[model samples]
Target: MLPYSEEHAQFRDTVRRFVEREVAPHHARWESEGAVDRDLWRKAGDAGLLLTNIPADYGGGDGDFLTSVIMIEEFMRGVFSGPGFRLHSDIVAPYILHLGTEEQKRSILPRMASGETIGAVAMTEPGAGSDLASIRTIARREGNELVVSGQKTFITNGGLADLIVVACKTDPAAGAKGVSLVLVEADRPGFSRGKNLEKIGMKAQDTSELFFDEVRVPASNLLGTEGKGFAHLMTELPRERLLVGIVAVSVMEAALCWTLDHVHERKAFGRPLIEFQNTRFVLAEVKTKVTVARTFLDDCVLRLMRGELDVATAAMAKWWLSDLECEVVDACLQMFGGYGYMREYPIARAYEDARVHRIYAGSNEIMKELVARSL
Candidate 1:
């Protein structure tokens, strides 16, 4: 609806078909296995579904940000949370594209585009979540090599990551200014992954703890300038937060549709659930809330395309829409009565998945603080 061209329309159709044919069938299996099949990434890459915004020279689809938006929207429409493609393409790839040197991009981005190598970013540590400045990961220089010593947890795609953009403290006394982004190859001697972490939701996505026990890499692997990692992260936060916003509204929209279908066919008292005044009122409220959220989401997406989106506005979108998503899903779940509690239902899975949106990409509380600082 946001001024999508004919190409966008066709792409959406392709994504919809792809999701139905490839993702939906195996999503339950992935959830049970605690990770999507490794081959899914290759299939997605072959379909031009990965790195939609990166340039063609790097083996990407040469599409814009809207293409990525279409991809996210279609995936959420079916409530399939198994693949970590969004994190792989939109989140982690950008860091490399924007910050890495030409040699880095030439060697890595093409393989990533081909899905031959998976990527992940390591930032969150056991003691540090929202407070990235407090992370204790140390990268000590030893001649031409850098020895990385620290642990990162809750890393998406960690188990399969072939390349990781690691956040390290190059100067411990300088606080946030001490942080630097170092690119570490996963096969390094001391680099290892813990078991895939189990979670309450998004069970099909692999999230794990990554340990760097003096993992070593060349000095040339440093991303951007030394001691500028926090600034680099700040430059990218708006996009990441906006991504959360995109997922939030997409899930809300899907949940509303599911609830609508259920209420129309489901019976309560002597008639359909939709016949009840209370049910009607709840649906009306949900519809209105979701409509408003969609409008705001579209505006933010347009701003992102125009390169005009600011940190505060992006923060508002992230926190507000994520909160609304959880609220809408909970209300929709309640409408299903006992059936909502069962895992067989899509709405139940949605209810479980809606929770982490508030906590990740900087918690909703952190988002509010960021906005307040701007005010």
Candidate 2:
């Protein structure tokens, strides 16, 4: 059995209660609406469920990495299916806390923790998905203000975010060295929202196309320096990928358990579906794979706690577990027979939602390349 401290277990219980009360009842409605209500964000912030890792001095909960991991795991287990909390709290907030100046942090952190503002990190443009050097978004400083101009697509939390951490080219001549990160407020002129792009799954997430047409912001908004964005991205990616790994493993665990339960209750030929040799073998394989995945993921979590989890390892965990998740879910859906194909079934929804894990936050192929660097 995996080990956990009493405090950690208690924290897990808290997360479960929050999910059961706040997430469970509204998930279907949110899924149908293509976006969750804004009030839920405030509820999470009120409960100290968002940005638990940032220090309490900045209005955060002052929780540890494990707390964030617990939240991710619990959210996945429930298939909460809405909001980009992982993208905001787990992924982007660290960049500001670790790298941004005092002014940047003070300007952004309090609102982020309070859920007074939504946060989004814009790194992927249509032209540059995985390849960072290919980014074409330009940020030119004219006097004391940085003028940003570009279009970013597939931005998570794009429609809802009040603050965006944007990546842009500061010196096109310097290639990868040209990139920089800056904070942009949604209320700023020339910074405008576009259509919420329709997607096959994760419909409640409110993905959108963001256009920055000569959006001008104060010098104080530049995160860190003018040319550290790509390197900063490299530094941040391991954590982001690690978070993705945590989500993948947790969801796979939930899906596996869900399938087992589903098959046991669903009978055919006067015997439960679980009685079939095929079903038993399938579940056995799933159980073993999920256990192995948990083992690796938990080890990664420990290493992350020790500040030793590297980019390559995170990539391995993410790609491998995500592939396993898709496989396990597809098998689970098969056990449901025709019922799984229907949109009303949770498994069917999961099957649809799980398809993108292999593709987003960098494709599995790109993940392999990152891992290959270790050799």
**Which sections of candidate 2 miss by over 4 Å?**
1-3
Clashing pairs in 2: none
Quote the lDDT for 27 in model 2.
84
Error of 1 at 159 (Å): 1.2
- Candidate 1, position 28, lDDT: 93
Best by TM-score: 1
What would the C-alpha RMSD of candidate 2 be, to one decimal place? Answer: 1.3
What are the per-residue Cα lDDT tens digits for candidate 1 across 241-358?
Answer: 9999999898888888989999999986779999999999999999999999999999999999899999999999999999999999999999999999998898999899989999
Q: TM-score of model 1 relative to the true fold?
A: 0.98
Question: What is candidate 1's local distance difference test score?
Answer: 0.92
Question: How many residue pairs collide in each prediction?
Answer: 0, 0
What TM-score do all the candidates reach, one by one?
Answer: 0.98, 0.97
Q: Where is model 1 more than 4 Å wrong at Cα?
A: none
